[model samples]
Target: MSYVGWMIFGVVLLVIEILTPTFFFLWFSIAAFLSGILAMFGLNLGWQVSVFAVASTLLVIFTRPIAKKIMGEAPRKVYVEELKNGVATVVQDIDSSKGTGIVKISGENWRALSVDPKKVIKKGEEVVIERIEGTTVYVRPIETEAKKEGEEI
Candidate 1:
C-alpha cells in the first residue's frame, strides 16, 4: 500500500483508540504512522511493512504490562475477622426455613439469616454473627454458643 494508505489507517486506528481505549491499538497506530513516515522517505514497501510489524510487537511487549499495572482493576479486599464472631441483636425473627431475618449490629440494621437451616432466631435475641454474605448476616443464637462456641458457625 501507498504511504497515503498507511497514513489513513493510522488516523483511523488512532480515532478508534481514542473512542475505546485498551492501551493496545494505539501502539499499532503508532507503528502505522511510523511506516507512513518511512514510506514518505522513499523506503521500500517491504521494509515499511516489516518496520510496522516489529515496532508494533515490540511496543506491545514492552509497554502493555506497564499500562495494565497503571490501569488494571483494583479489587477491594475483605477481612474475615472484621465480621466473624461479631455480636448482633436480632431485630426481626430469622427463619432460615423461610430464608428471611433481620439483625442490628453497631447500631445499623441488617438483613440476617441463620446458618443452620432448621434454626429460627427470635427477635430481640442476641446472636453471634458468624459471617457476612453480601448484605445478609448469618448468625446463630449466642445462648447456643457454649458447646457450639466458635462452632456457632
Candidate 2:
C-alpha cells in the first residue's frame, strides 16, 4: 500500500482507539500500518501479513507491563485512624462473647465488639475504640479513674 494509505489507516485506527478505549483493535491497526511499511519496501502480501502479526504481538506483550507500571497499582480507598483511641458511646449493650452490639461514635452508629471477648459492656457507657474489623469497631471501657480528678473527666 502507499505511504499515504498507511498513514490514513494509522490515523483512523488511532481515532477508533481513542473512542473505544479498549487498547485492543488499536494493535491490529498498528499492525496494518507496519505491514504498509513493509509493503512500501516491496514485501509481498504474505510477508507483510507475517511481519504485521509478529510486530503487533510483540507490541502488546511488551507494552502491557510498561503500561501497568506507568499506571501503577489501582488507587486504594483508605480509612484513616479515625476510630483509634477515639471515644464512642455504647448505644446498645455489648456482650463480647456473643459477638455484637452498637456504639455511637462521632454521631454515627457502628457495630462494635469488645477486643477482649471476656468483658460485657453496658449501654450509655463510654468506650475507647481499639481497632476496626471490617465495618465493626472493637472497643474497651475507657480508663476514667486516671482522670477522675480535675483532668477533664
Best by lDDT: 1
Across 7-102, the per-residue lDDT of candidate 2 in tens digits comes to: 687789888988974676678688878888878888877787688779889988887677667767765544548668999999999998787689
lDDT of 1: 0.88
The lowest-lDDT stretch of 10 consecutive residues in candidate 1 is 74-83
Report how far residue 97 has shifted in candidate 2, in Å.
1.5
Give candidate 2 regions above 4 Å deviation: 1-80, 146-153
Q: Which stretch of 10 consecutive residues in model 2 shows the poorest summed lDDT? A: 74-83
How high a TM-score does candidate 2 get?
Answer: 0.43
Top of the candidates by TM-score: 1
List pairs with backbone clashes in candidate 2: none
